[model samples]
Target: MFLDEHTAKQQIVAFAKSIFDRGLTSGASANMSVRIENAWVMTPTNTCFGFLNAEELSVVGLDGTLLKGLPPSKEFRLHKAMYDQRPNDRCIIHLHSTYATALSCISATDNSNVVPTFTPYLTMRLGPIAMVPYFAPGDDALAESVGKVAAKHAGIIMANHGPIVSAETVESCVYGMEELEESCKLALLLKNENANTLTAEQINFLLNKFKK
Candidate 1:
């Protein structure tokens, strides 16, 4: 079920603080949006996740008009693109978390699925992560690129930037983002080792069993 605006604001603020308190994201480098009927209650532009004010959160109509509160995130298009493609998803979180951003800075062998399946949680929660080529932050082109892959990816790693995760609820979106970060950490940690990544069959089984 979609959240009502008030609860969406509270959930956004609560989870944003939770993420920031845990060092999942730093400063004003992250943003989140939650679907509430025909509009989205989103974090305001330049607001730190740790310091969000629920009463001051922005609300944008589904067509992208600002309906209330402070201005929505400058990267609002990124969230819009994903919401448009994933109709069933109610929340989207984009973070510049360290490990995931570090992974983004590297050249991925497969941009279609950047993170390797070092563990099942990432795949179970986010499926394959698409890596969009770098575009300056807030560039509409970045949103366009994200739109191209959002339908197939519940999670994405923007090159030279970081990860964006979406889910049917606030909790799932946060957990998926954490899983993405953890997966990136494991991938970097075992980069030089002969890590026995999960095989194709195993990954497919997970995709079928856990993904909707």
Candidate 2:
């Protein structure tokens, strides 16, 4: 599918509006983007979700030039690196929903910290969530660091930061992000109880059934 500049602008505005209505983020805590042909359409820096207009979205060339709108978000490297590697990724969402951000602030890979196999839908959407080491926000090093496993992850938790999801569409990306947050919420709720935990056998079955 060819993504025209006009459509890219609309998707950027619409995606921001949808997530804003869902209360996924507030202030300037999140950014959304889409790959349009070889370039990308992204939300501009310091913009509020509630007030985004199509004209305000930024057009960034694949080679990293700011082609239109206000300057892009500080998380430019994070978005660019994903599109540079994942040819099919059309939408990207980086959000800081309350519980997800809290969990990320304290997550370590040693936690066996996969987002859990608690829900079939979540499992199917975000296959494996990677845990990336902490870097100062908007740091180029953060984006390059994630390049190590870009071939495997759909959503990755930025240690002490938040979550980033890339998918074939905006809705799918949003759903995966929500699932990531929900999984974290579910884990907290069941941390004290041994109930509903996935058995090794069940996980093995799922692993076999959901091979991407």
For all predicted structures, in order, the TM-scores are 0.98, 0.91
Best-matching candidate per TM-score: 1
What C-alpha lDDT do the candidate models reach, one value each?
0.94, 0.79
lDDT of 2 by residue, 133-191 (tens): 88998888999977666657777888888888888887788888888888878867776
Q: Judging by lDDT against the true structure, name the best candidate.
A: 1
Query: Against the hidden true structure, what lDDT does model 1 obtain?
Result: 0.94
Candidate 1: where is the Cα deviation over 4 Å?
none
- Worst-scoring 10-residue span by lDDT in model 1: 203-212
RMSD vs true structure, all candidates: 0.7, 1.9
Model 1: per-residue lDDT, tens digit, 1-212? 88899999999989999999999889899999999999999999999999999989999998889999999999999999999999999999999999999999999899998999989899899899989999999999999999999999999999999999989999999999999999999999999999898999999999999983
Candidate 2 residue runs with Cα over 4 Å from true position = 109-113, 204-212
lDDT computed for candidate 2: 0.79
